[model samples]
Target: MNIPNTYGHLPLAAEAAGAGHPVLTWAAVGVIVTAVGVCLVVLHRRRDTRSKRLTPGYDAATGALVVLDRLSAMTAIAGVTTELGELAGFISLLRVAEARSPEIPFGVIVATLDDYAASVFTANYATRLAADPSLLDSYLALARVQGVKLESARTAITTVQRRIEKLTGK
Candidate 1:
């Protein structure tokens, strides 16, 4: 006599009766497919939103251009001052940068330059600012010369960034 075997333990009819295995398996597969579909939809939407935000033709582009323009303007101001006078002028420009472009990470550079300028000024004119008001004017004139060079340094940073973007097609 032949007997049906369900994995050598029971008949197929007995196993099928014990649980609706086929229906449960199909339900699980359906759920998995639905979950995968949902995930794909969400991922696609996120990618689309990100693309819109990062596109070079959008608001990011405008912000970058504005920053570049401001840097260029500062550079032009720096060109007319003498080396010593540049220092004071650069200090002023760095103040502007700090106010307008706080995200540029230029605070350290500006602070270093300011500290050096102050040290030089104090060393040279510590006794003058207290005597003659005209002495303060003279000190400012000298500081302005150094300020211009600091402005040039800032401009160099902007130029370097532009070059990198060009090379990378960014």
Candidate 2:
């Protein structure tokens, strides 16, 4: 004699006619499926907010300031080659800073870098160095001579850095 299993995958009609209530089994399956759906919805919402969460405290904030300090220093270089070198390092660090600290609006810095690369250098981060690397020296010297124009960039970077630090209490 085969003993009927209420929780088995076998459908009710497939089992002995009087074994159990098929309706009850179907209702239980419906409840399980609904619970799973609710859980998935909750997790999806949480995943978005999770990345924005920054590590709280002074250390991480201080580290972020260091990157800002370097970016500020990079603005002082009028030399194309030196500036490009600084840009490369700064861009790499900026990506890290953006990921590590949500408080910093890194996209703004990227825009500024993009503008400088396009206008002052007449080339982007990738192509700038490739074009007559020898010209970098002259271009930088010219920019340095006209350094007054870079002051605004220095101010903007510092201001953003301070704002982010203030939020971090660093």
Candidate 3:
């Protein structure tokens, strides 16, 4: 009986076919699977560590204070818009912190931030009303309301910061 060498030109292919390199192929697959599994585990650990660090703590409190300070300094439409963008980012951080640790009293502060945003909206509306001189009193009233809301939010953030400082002993 004569066997034809179908892979006459490819020496490696002929040798692999005769040798039936099933073990080598399985070993390569096993190595690839192990590499992928290791990568997934490492990625999972990194994500867990990052999330743990982001949990509401001293850093978050300090960040809130900074955001609040910047927010308070903004008066013009452009400045206010920028500050509000920062505020929204800060709120997202707080929300993440809240999710990580439900024990923390972030709900109330989050609510305060919402109220602050609403007051800013009110102020924006009042500013638009400035075009109508007849609405001067209404605009002034809204401005005053916004000022009060700012103070309230500032107070809330400061209180949280103080508590965190005391807790951390820093």
Candidate 4:
């Protein structure tokens, strides 16, 4: 049996041997439209993902300050203010440094406090103090006696407070 080649092997052909490429049909148009719609949807989802994944800097700073505030309030020793004053001075230095270099980690302050509290009593106690503000007058005195330069720590609180308030207003 012999099979007849009804149509030429070339898919695109001119009926009169002079017609150009075939005109795209509605099915092709539908496919193109569907592809464009899918691309749009992917772009939208990527934007949403970026927004949702962004970390909250303002909230984190507020939380850290609250812990420090609580620890300050709970501590009760003669010149407790002075001992913590040195630590506060360190914070002030950090704040100023941060102003100069925003890449500074907030954890630096937290870690310093944790170490100072450990020298006085225990890390657990310091953490509790962080949660509630306990004792450390001697540490403050030693810091002052050794010239830790706590002037900035003493006044940096107000600066930090103002900065936070301004951020809040925005």
Q: Which candidate comes out best when scored by lDDT? A: 3
lDDT of 2 by residue, 28-146 (tens): 99999999999988886665443334333222334434544554464433354454555556656665666666556765555555455443433353366566697678766756643
Best by TM-score: 3
lDDT (tens digit, per residue) of candidate 1 on 1-170: 98876567645784867864688878999999999999999987866654443333223223433443343333222333143364455456555554554444345545645543443444425556777777877767756654564455455445534543443345
Q: TM-score order of candidates, best first?
A: 3, 2, 1, 4
RMSD of each: 11.1, 14.8, 14.4, 14.8
The list of candidate 4 runs beyond 4 A from truth reads 1-55, 76-112, 115-169
- Candidate 3 lDDT tens digits, 12-59: 774867866679888999999999999999987865665555435546
Q: What TM-score would you give candidate 4 relative to the actual structure? A: 0.27
lDDT of 4 at 13: 54
What is candidate 2's TM-score against the reference?
0.37
TM-score of 1: 0.31
Candidate 4, residue 10: how far the Cα is off, in Å: 69
- The model with the greater lDDT, 1 or 4, is 1
Per-residue lDDT value at 157 in model 1: 46
TM values, all candidates = 0.31, 0.37, 0.57, 0.27
